[model samples]
Target chain A: MTDALKPGATIGILGGGQLGRMLSVAASRLGFKTHIFDPGANPPAGQVADQVTTAGYEDSAALLAFANAVDVVTYEFENIPTAALDIIESHGPIRPSREALRISQDRLTEKTFLQSLDLHIAPFADITDAASLEAALAEIGTPAILKTRRFGYDGKGQARIMSPDQADEALNAMAGAPSVLEGFVNFSHEVSVIAARGITGEVACYDPGENVHRDGILHTTTVPARLSASQRMDAVLLAAKVLNALDYVGVLGVELFVTPQGLVVNEIAPRVHNSGHWTQNGCAVDQFEQHIRAVAGWPLGDGQRHSDVVMENLIGDDMDRLPELAKERDCALHLYGKAEAKPGRKMAHVNRITRPQK
Target chain B: MTDALKPGATIGILGGGQLGRMLSVAASRLGFKTHIFDPGANPPAGQVADQVTTAGYEDSAALLAFANAVDVVTYEFENIPTAALDIIESHGPIRPSREALRISQDRLTEKTFLQSLDLHIAPFADITDAASLEAALAEIGTPAILKTRRFGYDGKGQARIMSPDQADEALNAMAGAPSVLEGFVNFSHEVSVIAARGITGEVACYDPGENVHRDGILHTTTVPARLSASQRMDAVLLAAKVLNALDYVGVLGVELFVTPQGLVVNEIAPRVHNSGHWTQNGCAVDQFEQHIRAVAGWPLGDGQRHSDVVMENLIGDDMDRLPELAKERDCALHLYGKAEAKPGRKMAHVNRITRPQK
Candidate 1:
């Protein structure tokens, strides 16, 4: 049984970062070897995986060689170059499908898809120029945020138009890239639903966790979040519906805006998200394992929460506290091997878990 | 502060096996590189570790190069060859110290050391030959187990001697190796205490987990084990006492046999033990992260268990069940990428978590 696919099965990972590193670790735990493909020098994921392929996403020869070496392909980030996916898909199975990738890569398409499904999302309008910006601004209103439809992450590629006077500057900041202007949600708190779907159409969801952000980056996520039981149920149901609609495979993180009105969908990340880090410490199945199971065409395990959990990011230089942190009776500390501690970069995270109330 | 130790910081691993593979994963998580010194060609640890040095225990030149390349040294097994330790110590730090490894390599020495520290161990005696085996049998009676003095794992290097007539066969079975004759323990249950001590001597412990074994190999470990609060305290205290007495650094596993009378020291694993797998799925601070913390000279994190948990291993053909296991909502499955699944060999494991009663 092992000879056909017993763990030495190489899994090709696209993009190299902390998420990929964690995923490689999860895959290795289940007997699968990971082959990391990333252009970045010394990708964090490359440090631990069985092999590393350092080539640009545009290199077809490198992509084909990587694909030939793996049984299946998965990714950590969504903004992967389309050419890379094309070459890899030509050689191996790609989870969640290229359609999911294309749709998620474009905000305009994502919003349209959600609206078509009759799902809840903030009101939005596309802007191509000064006329489009002025028209979209009038329709979506002031105090709205302007975001490029592609390549946005960790507070990058977006600016807020607090008033009409700043709209021109915001529009010029994008340098003429197609953009979307969205009205802000008046939500009391932020939360995320991390769910995984298998190729067999099986779907599994973690209990939604309340997330707190600082300077537009996730700071912490706490499980058994302060939500009514009905609210939690509603969140899970909405996430399952989205995964079903996309015919998705692998882990998908749905960031939600919880308002007095109810749970409204904000955005969906086709890959793992920071908000799900609590699973690493709080549940039997961390997001990394869940994603591997989904893409491996294996049956999913129980995602039940056994305790109240809190996961906090250790950004920048806070990694210095690892010694003291390690002394705690129940703490899980993970540090990404990023050499540079630039401001706003996520360095690591710690999860503090408590016994679930009986 | 990670800059203090660049990406190539050489990590020295003592024992070479799957545990080393997992530790290599954790080390890569923090950007530290590792050099594994193992004598076997097919070491599970070497498959993933960055570098491998295959040489005899007494190979001085190989040991010198290994020490010179590594910034710090850690190990995977307790029974490291004493000569190997002498060589590593001459070049760099040999974690857990030679004394700990020397004492732990022999059952009688370990028991004696425990007794000297006011700790308790199962009744045991040193058996040098057939005559000594007869004497031990006469004194300790039938059903006593004889184990080799060093280099034993799983069910290897141990035999249960039940009849006086079988003394010669048992001694022969030991291959003339120095052995320990241990009286069978009348235990109600089995458990383990996993903890880490940093270079600064700060220690952290996860809650003890009840363990079950089949064929002398670990089967499952469940957290929030059925033990009184005081009993848990005793387990932690016992582990700390052993660590301090040995002046051990890095991760250690102290297995205990739980009996009606009280706790008895089963054995001490100088490195990470299989029983600590529950931490990977059910606790915030897992054993792998803690080991990394100790070796990195960094502060330790909290080792809290957040869920009531069950960890099940994948043996031989069990790797085929991974897809099904992934569909469970909170199942954490780990497969060690062994190329072969020969009978009784560890292939992988899964963890299932139950939420606390709210």
Candidate 2:
């Protein structure tokens, strides 16, 4: 096994969005330089990262250079091409491992992996073709969601079906890509556990946060989630189980649905989750730092929340509220340096301290 | 007055030390890009800043180009050359104003300015020559400090005159430079208030943090300092007084001595100060962001302490403790991306939460 990375080591991060941007900032705080690799130009991460390679993941030459320049590799997104991972892994260790990525990249694989651990999850069926899609629909019944098995995020590559009559239209929307149909969860509320595991197999979890979504986009995450003590314990334990099962060496974001029966796993992000953004103001060591510490093989930090925080995302035109939000007492405004405020884009966020209430 | 800067505006920062590094990170969080200018190559600020101009402040062309590229200019140090400021000011506004820099750069001018405002300060006199030094020493008495009026910081360019017999040697230590002889204040302890003034003239101050110096270097700053409620109010009000006196448009660090006679102003920094580092873990909005917000003409944030914190600087060999310190609970580590841990150099710091104990 490789030795723990010392300060001044370069951390190569794949995908250069807000998560990558935040991770870059956290790495710098720990005295580690970050090199960002993304196909997009002027990525948010590039604004703060030490280096930026604006080349597609398919560019093996660029990927090789990135991996070789940094002591270790980590990613902000899970949908990186397996081919790119293969080239990068040959040069350095990739935190969370290739196995975690392989499973998380496909809905079918992710669900099956969770089931293998005997964890509770929504009932799902893999949709390879129209015949199978219809057959799976018959078993799953109505009010289910059709999702692309791969490359689906933020409600993209998804369609909702309320009745059997809509199955063909939903299937057509998939455009012949592999898909998964999940029975709609009867959840009272959604919560996420931001958990991390160090390279030495040590795990830590932040308090679960209750999340609210608008138009399939995360709107806000409030700490002190509406969960009983036992429920909170269950969430953290299950999250730890997943990390250990995957032998993950970085942060994993586990989303769950609170139901009458029990908490059901909805999805998992193999990186810092949006729901945990509240930790930036509420905890001593935030999720980004925890991820950096774990990836660098350093000891995990205290994940305890010091105050009640409500993290609200500034989406697109939500940036309009910034002038007023900037004046709000006990509010910590964190804006991603995105040039344009496009619709549904996460432009910024405000972590408002609700405890020691004013 | 210039209108408030919108998100995505570039902020030009002079100096690229740890303070600049932190300012860059804070500016990025507010969706403002920072361009760091420093004579040193590969400065700590460059690790996270959007851009770095590794050119001397004497390079007027480079300074002008830098100033014209950003919406506003601020600094991490007060010792910037006046000629450079003249060139930069022609292109963009400099927050905290040039007057603040001019006054704070010179000890005599700073003390005189404070005295004019009816603020209590140590008795001081200007010494342009040995004869004047002797005269000032006689008036200020023994046990006074001889300091260079300009370009002195962190115990540099200072000599103590403990007795009349040592006057000649102390004067020689000045090396023919302009100097100031100030009678030291007999105080209980030193504390600093990190205060900010927005362009619109609004003011906000973080709670005073008790300071301790080791060999004239800052050792620790603990917030919720050992002060009565009245002393805290006095500190905040005096800090605000300094900001308003200068019509300051950014964060200022005000060092004060709590004496039996009341609070006596020691020094005022026109930018974020080391004593204010505790705010990073103690308050919702840190000094860096407060400085950024003020410079950007945004509204000030709540500076109230949510958690008590003790910030300790990890100077040089202190880095050896990072391994164990990283494992400490409720500790937030901030390391500057400095390549070498040279003796007396600040490599990193740890803000440990001490309140709501353990």
Candidate 3:
């Protein structure tokens, strides 16, 4: 609490994609230089950063140099290995703590953490073996989602059970590894809260964003979601509770399933989330800046929305709408300079602003 | 029109400061690199650009080398030396054509240009030596501002006249250079329109910003300015008129005086401006990116406000608010990474968002 991040201090970032690219922009805006360490030779974040280290995550020598160069360390994506965390944590401080990642990375552990908080969660059970898979499927019933315990995103490494007979197929598909069976909930909508907790334990949460996903990829996020006041409050409280519980010191996104009863925790991202992209044009300080502030030992920014916004992710050929989108009276378009707009690729995004009558 | 600007294209910035620094950031964002040809090294824009050429405005060799390296050149300021532009035009296409700069670079010429378009302007007269100054003073009269014909900003290089004797001092203070004696129209408020004209002659304007200045330095700009519907339309149309007149292919700021009669043209900046800082948070495509797109022969973006915003310039001691500003809910603070915040120096700015209530 006694230390304030000084200008010229370098922030070391793990993972180098568009999120990292934007985080570097935010870090530099606050007079903090960023050093990016990504195994990829040409990570997007490296383009505008002060320096970049293109070495393997397991290369302890390069990791040490990166940690030594930066005053603080953080990551854009949560999938970084535990060994990579250990290597960096042994040197500079890593915000959002490893405990947070350890919990969020595992479906069973994440569900358990949510249940302990007396929060609503998707009905789920751990499946360690074929027998347990059958029992869990019998209990949760058909049309249940069977997901690997770790390393899953964008619909990867996961399968769904439409009937009891499909349980064996799903478990065998995971190659007999640990899994989680989630009972499908007839939720009304999907929403997410992107919040941050500072080093001093101050927490701030942005308003919930209504998210729509297509083909397991986020398609759009509209802010000031059409949620009841109670639902919004519950979502913010859940995000803050997660941050405080984990002793997190950076921005995190809590995805929630909104049902007729209330909000249920889906998953937590211990980093900036794509759903918060609307903040780039709708809020005062964007989620990227908020993350930078929290990890830099600076105060968390006010996470208030200034305008009703709709952020649409430009996947693949959706990028062709740049001209069409930009011509929309108040639409904001952002195109990441990815070489190819292959199918299912996240090439860019568009944010459309509308005035909510006061 | 089908050709997109390539990397290594020269972006000819007229003024070397933080706006240029941030503009350089936007240029690199799209993979189109910039070569800043500011007269000095270590300019804020120079810090992040691919290359910087240091030379006087009159140096043809340096200008030619800079122009030859890039496909097209775009300026960051309007008052570029005519001699310098002469050389650059010989080597590369200068977007926002030099005609735009010529009209904007001087107060008298700008007023005349606007008048030619049937646009309203502050009543003004040109002054060269003592006799003309006396007659021009009588026409424009006392209680008006006496501004140098060239090189003025943030209240510098100008003098105020209140009486007959003060006129002599004001004239002498300008070092006997040509000047513009303008009648100070008592106005209720001031604002600016930041807009872009694409290569195809399309125009897009961001919402006008109500501007306030202190000690000649811009202090704050609030979006969705307190102007009548007619005034807003007039301001935007006037800006488009200026852009069309120049065949301008870049972003420009047109400052206006909201007098009792109507919105009158005040001044024009042939590049990104301090008053339009709100775009960084309030709009999807910031003024900088719009400038990049226009100069690159790309379609112009939607220059619309996503939220009501107040942009306050962090000048000198004001920069110390970084800590609190960061913590303040819903305030997006942007700092220029300046090593020192010297008096009258622009260190950064903060945009506070005020979203319309649903």
TM-score per prediction, in order, is: 0.91, 0.98, 0.89
Clashes per prediction? 54, 0, 5
What is the RMSD of candidate 1?
A: 3.3
TM-score of chain B of each: 0.92, 0.97, 0.94
Report the C-alpha lDDT of model 2 over A1-358, residue by residue, as the tens digit. 2477899999999989999999999999899999999999999999899999999989999999999999999999998888999999999899979999999999999999999999999889999888887898899887999999999988999999999899899999999999999999999999999999998999999999999999999999998899999999999999999999999999999999999898999999999989999999988899999999999999998587888899999999999888888878889989999999999999999998888321
Interface RMSD of 2: 3.6
TM-score of 3: 0.89
Q: Output the lDDT of residue B347, model 3.
A: 90
Model 2 lDDT tens row, B1-358 = 2388987899999999999999999999999999999999999999998999999988988998898888899999998888999999888799889999999999999999999989999999998887887888788887899998988888999999998788789889989889999997999999988899998899998888899999889999987788898988888888888888898999999999999998999999899999999888878789999999899988887687888899999999999998889989889999999999999999999998877321
Question: lDDT per residue, candidate 3, B196-277, as tens digits?
Answer: 8888888999889999999888898988889889888888788888888787888999888888888888888888888888
The reply for model 2, stretches above 4 Å from the true place, is A356-358, B356-358
The list of candidate 3 runs beyond 4 A from truth reads A123-141, A164-168, A175-178, B1-16, B25-42, B46-71, B81-87, B111-145, B164-168, B176-188, B223-230, B258-264, B301-303, B354-358
Q: Encode model 3's per-residue lDDT on A70-122: one tens digit a residue.
A: 89999988878889889899997988788988888898899999899888888
Q: Name the weakest run of 10 consecutive residues (lDDT summed) in model 1 chain A.
A: A1-10
The number of clashing residue pairs in model 1 is 54
Docking class of 3: acceptable
Candidate 1 TM-score versus the reference: 0.91
